[model samples]
Target: MTITGRCYCGELTYCIESEPIMKGNCHCRECQYFSGGHPNAFLVMSDSTFQYTKGKPKTFTRSDLEKPRTREFCGNCGTHICTKSEFRPGAIVLKAGTLDDMSLFDKPDMAIFTIDKQPFHHLDADVPSYERMKP
Candidate 1:
């Protein structure tokens, strides 16, 4: 199933060739800070199968304890688009809200990094929640 997405400004567009491997909301402090919200729901796609349909997105390599991760966003609007890691080769996590048809993806399987989750946000106890990245 091919999926289409665009940046907030619609200046940058992308297409993914396959169904996402996973979909989930991340509550890590980094993600919360970057998104300016509770958590970010993202679709995991293969880097090789993801293509830019319009304008090149500006990329920034995040510096942290983990391996370097590259963040791609619209240069004009600064809409956070995708995050890719060489360490996790072939996988790119695309921000789900950016997709033109977000309903096409399955509901998130779980929430991660709940240790830093916002106090006001309440998640279902039934869903698997991880204190940090699952092993």
Candidate 2:
């Protein structure tokens, strides 16, 4: 399945030529901060099938972490686009909200980092949830 997306300001665009390897929500503190106090819905896609179709995105990797996940975002709009992790090489974690068709990620396959999930953060009863990262 081909998926097309762009940043909020349309400064950066991307295309995913393959299906996602995983679809889930992350409730980690970092995700909550980036997502404005909510769990981050994401699609894990193969790096080989993803490409920037327009302008380049700015990237950031926390200097404090020994092994930090690299975040890619629109420099102009500050839209969180995708993230690349050293632990999950060859995979790009795309922010579901950035997709042109948001309905494609209607439900998460799982909800992770629940240990850090806030009291106000609600997940569907049927959505499998993990206290931390799924093994």
Candidate 3:
């Protein structure tokens, strides 16, 4: 399935050519601060299948975890667009909220980094939840 999305200001546009291998909500502190919310959903696509169409995004190297990861965002509105990992080899995680037709993707299968989850928001018990990043 082809999925398309754009940044809040419409300056950055993207297209993904395949179904995401995984989708989930991330509740890590970095994600919370980046999204300004409790959790942010992501659709994981192959890096080779994801393409930026409109403009180049401003990138920030946000972490030095097991893998070095960079976040790409619209410079104009500072909309978090996607996260890429140099160590992951072939994957790109796109911020689901940026999708123009998000309904096209299945509901997220799980939640990750729940150890940092906000205290007030409860998640559904049916989905598998992880204390830290999912493997």
Error of 1 at 75 (Å): 0.8
lDDT of 1: 0.85
Candidate 3 displacement at residue 79 in angstroms: 0.7
If the candidates were sorted by their lDDT against the true structure, best first, what order would they fall in? 2, 3, 1
lDDT, residue 67, model 2: 96
Candidate 3: stretches off by over 4 Å: 63-66
Report RMSD for candidate 3: 1.7
Best TM-score goes to which candidate?
2
Preferred candidate (TM-score higher): 1 or 2? 2
Model 2, which residues run further than 4 Å from truth? none
lDDT of 2 by residue, 10-127 (tens): 9999998988888999999999999999999999999897999999999999999999999999999999999999889999999999999999898999999999999999988999
Which residue pairs in candidate 1 collide? none
Residues 1-135, candidate 3, lDDT per residue (tens digit)? 788999999999999888788899889888888878778889888888788899999998845566668899999999999998875669988899999997965677899999989886578889899998777
The window of 10 residues in a row where model 2 has the poorest summed lDDT is 13-22
lDDT of 1 at 5: 89
- Model 1, position 108, has a per-residue lDDT of 81
Task: Please list the C-alpha lDDT of all candidates, in the order they appear.
Answer: 0.85, 0.95, 0.86
